[model samples]
Target: MDRIRKIFLVSINNIRKWATNPRIYVLFILITMFLWSSIRPILSFSKEMGIRVTPWVFPHLASSFVGQLILMLGVVLLFCDAPFIDEGQPYFLIRSGRYTWGMGQVFYIMMGMTIYLLIVNFISILILMPNIFLSTGWGKILGTLAENHGESVNEIEYISKKILLSYTPLKAFVLSFILEWCAGTALALLMFVINICLNRAAGATIASLIILLDYAIYSNFPSVKFFYFSPVSLSKLILIDSKGISNYPSNEYAYIFFIITIIVLSIISVLSVRRKDIQVQPAV
Candidate 1:
């Protein structure tokens, strides 16, 4: 209980400091809101064209937002250098349980991500609902068009069905978090590896190379199960249709592959951190 309390206090203090930083949070909020707001027009346009939108749209936007969140979070972890030795007179000593401290950081990151996702989701739902109604209620306009074109209402039925079927918020959040955690952690690990290897610039180059390689392989040859290790591939697995993942009929295997890959990657990351040398250098 004492250890848990200590960890909680440490985490709380870290969050407080972060929260006090107004500029970063403000910019983050603005960018996310802007992205969420942009979807309104798209929803309106789709409705006008006799197309229905899916609730899946929210999660898709959320996924992209989470990706950007992960990227920013990675920069913070890498540049701030948490749980590692810092030369600036250790403010809070790990003293006994270093593992706890590391775990605390993990928990903090996950919590921060969850909160961010929830807030953005709430804003998106608020902004999108009325626009969706306007788009779908174009009954008279649609009727005139259908009569002129000699087409039946069945032409727009697919969109209507899609709108009705696609609003899986719970599923979207679960899938979004899973992909976000995997991608976020991977990026952080990559940044850590880069920091250890060739300074910031070199690490950026290597990380970019890795991302490109991951995308290239997944796009060209997805049949190989190992590609699931790549965050992009993992996101694809979550977002794309089961068969869309490399044409394999059974997606069960792909999911299993992703789980195993995430485990392996996580283990490797922990080991890397455990063995990493802590030496402060110029922040790049």
Candidate 2:
């Protein structure tokens, strides 16, 4: 118990120092602005139509555009090196045993991912404050069927059906927030594991490219959507088919996959960090 408390204190201190960096705030603002841009048109349309929009709409749209690609890359860049490559790492490890240090990194990565998503989603909700409201129901616009009969017909119908059949707005939003945080943590762990074997920049690049490639392959061959690393599958699980529904993997399966992936990646990360040599130069 005492050892655990010590590790928690050390991890919290590390998080505090990390939180003080201006780049973190800059990234938050940049991401918030980018997400707002994507949602601005939808909010404008909702206003023009004089319809009340669900609070979840902004987060749903933001998650779709942000996608697994950006989420994985953002986490990789934000946390890959900070955990193990700092010049202060040796001192930290000496003060807090290897296991504690490893656990601290895990805690930091998980907390950072959660906080980052919370801030992004909070900003999105704030942007649509006028329209945001709690409801166990779908918004009128989303509940309505798409009138278009061309290439978008199938996509629109799928999304409408999924939203109508799935959990309530607030329930869905909460589930999505939790699931996306888990998925992001798994992705961050994977990056950290890679960074243990490679430099931070290379680790981030390779991990990001791996996700992008998975997305590309999943796009071309929908049958492969059940693959564990498929970003499309993760997005489906996180966004609840906000963009559109796919035929390969169901929402249930995607959620299960993320849970399993999280467990697996977390184990790998902790084991790797425990055995890793903390010799890298401090991050610039």
Q: Report the C-alpha lDDT of model 2 over 1-284, residue by residue, as the tens digit.
A: 98788668766766776566666666677776776765555456567667766666532442453444555566665775644556556777788787777888888777788788887777767887776555667776455431221122233222234444556777666766766677677767777788786767777676677667655665676565445456434554333443435544556766787778877877777788778776756653
Best by lDDT: 2
**For model 1, how does the per-residue alpha-carbon lDDT over 1-284 read when each residue is reduced to its tens digit?**
87777667655655665555554466467755565555555455556666544333434443342434334443343333333334431344345254555444444544554555555556665665654433333234333432443133323211222212333445544665565555555554555445554455555555555556554664686465555445555553233344443432233544565566545644544465456654554322
Which ten contiguous residues of candidate 2 have the minimum total lDDT?
149-158
- Per candidate, the number of residue pairs that clash is 0, 0
Model 2, position 240, has a per-residue lDDT of: 44
The residue pairs found clashing in candidate 2 are none
Model 1 misplacement above 4 A: 26-30, 46-55, 62-89, 129-173, 193-209, 218-229, 237-284
How big is the RMSD of model 1? Answer: 7.3
